[model samples]
Target: MGSLRLTFACGDYDRTRALHEGTVRPDGIELISLRLPVEETFFRMMRHHEFEVAELSLSSYVKSLDQDPSPFVALPVYPSRQFRHGGIFVNAAAGIEEPADLRGRVVGTPEWQLTAGVWIRGILADRHGVPVDSVEYRTGGQETPGRIEKAAVDLGEQIRIAPIPEDATLSEMLADGRIDALQSPRVPSTFRPGGGVRRLFADPVAAEKEYFTATGIFPIMHVVVVRRDVYERYPWVAQTLTKALHLAKREAMANLYDSSALRFSLPWLIPGLEEARALMGEDFWSYGLEANRNALATFLRYHHEQGLSRRQYAPEELFAPEATEAFVI
Candidate 1:
């Protein structure tokens, strides 16, 4: 039989470039890769199951597990990971000098189930003194108006969540001090000089490094998922695609450390890579279930604690069993 064809949508990260450019094809499968914005990819995939495989928000994926028949099954392949200390933007006049000061404040988030928001909230509640429900959460668009949660969620009465006016945007609300703080992966327009927005942590890099030291978690933002129907019909696709993703990530890491020439625009890529290796060790951005279990478990715990998930979920439940292990040579 001919190789099965599958549509895969994901961000154009260097790690996934090998797959996109046709250098790292999955075994027994033909990938029709589409480089789309993360938001668009997520919205289309979650709402309509637009792709056979796609990168999805970790938190949103967790939330979807609460559904009686979840629409997707994940492969422990994390396409995006980032420490979100810098993602917390606060109004200058809000007097939010520390995370603890966020108590009883109005915080705007693009979506309650956003991976970045989940990480930010979990970090605040875990390390800092901030409780998950201490602040009132207002959900709306960050730049434009009328953006809704890509996945439907109702945290119920215990956690306070409200939607902003259809005509309103989080950026403008944060700038005008309508909301005291905003948790977002994207920087708001009002984050410039005299724009009345500043990160809660003045030195986010130092704070993030410190957080990693404390928690040993470089937060995972996205995971690769196959539509449930596709997986059920062709279960082997999970492991095959997982292997391809791991190979692609290895290629990107190899390129990152290739000192012959700069692979990225950053002038100090070598020093940065060296520093990261020193801090997090080689293979810092590891793929698969075993390497990432702690981080995954922590995130799942946070998701349940923040009332996003219907019940606490174990990390192992997130991915397909076929992708969780491989045959030894």
Candidate 2:
């Protein structure tokens, strides 16, 4: 048989490289990496029919599947450490003490439709008694109406108006005091100014825990998916790839600093890498079948409720049969 051709799409090039070098079976798998912007990668996958297996954020993947669900099937790969979303960084001098203080505040965000942003708005509106329509929302571009719509539906009229900008940096805006608070998934170190940016309350993991408690679904961050036809033709590919990824995760975790330093040639990640190594020691990166199914089901249910998708396909329809059967709940 000819070598199996596989392609991976990743958000971080360095992580992708580490996974590629550390995990993939070189002999049987002809793994190729593509460098494409996240938004453009989705369209390119549709246009070129390029990859067999692709890595993608579950939100974006669901959006793509909503456009056409037949070509792709999402597979669970790894679960990232839970991180807070919509980190509201306020100028220390703003005296914004509580969530209610965000009223009439100018907030900066990267993506308007991002799940993090939507969820943050929902929590703030529901818990803080803050009027949803009273705050001003700014996006980098005018092409963020969809995100706005999602937020509006989730938050009601509590969201007042939308601001579009040709070129605006949230960090710079925060530093210059152009915006009162900036919301993002994670706080970048660069965002901290002398007395400008200070973090407000973030949705604790308990909130996410409650979400899981209610729905049996954890919000999916990223997933591995393959074309439906490709899986049909290459039955063994699923097991092969999963095993390879498991091995890769193990090796990478064991030698996190050495591997990361070797790949990046920088010491920036050394400390964090050591911490991650210690934290994730002996913890396998691979998710069992039941865990992945639940995550996907939760994601699909969310998108459906939000009107982002219409059809409700089963979890089995999104992965190889063996993979579906591999890790029974």
Largest TM-score belongs to which candidate? 1
Candidate 2 lDDT, 1-329, residue by residue in tens: 88777776654543345556544474477777666665555445655656777765555555555544456665556524243433667766676888789998888766655555544565566556655455787654222332222222233453444554446466666666777777767574445545457777545444444544554444445666677688778766676666555555555655655752464556666765565445434342436556456555654554444344456655555556665554452
User: All candidates' lDDT scores?
Assistant: 0.92, 0.57
TM-score for candidate 2, please give it: 0.65
| Off by more than 4 A, model 1 | 193-195, 327-329
The CA lDDT at 82 in model 1 is 97
Please identify model 2 stretches exceeding 4 Å from their true place: 11-19, 26-28, 34-50, 79-81, 93-95, 122-136, 141-163, 186-190, 202-219, 232-236, 256-286, 292-307, 310-321
lDDT of 1 at 81: 98
In the predicted model 1, the residue pairs found to clash are none
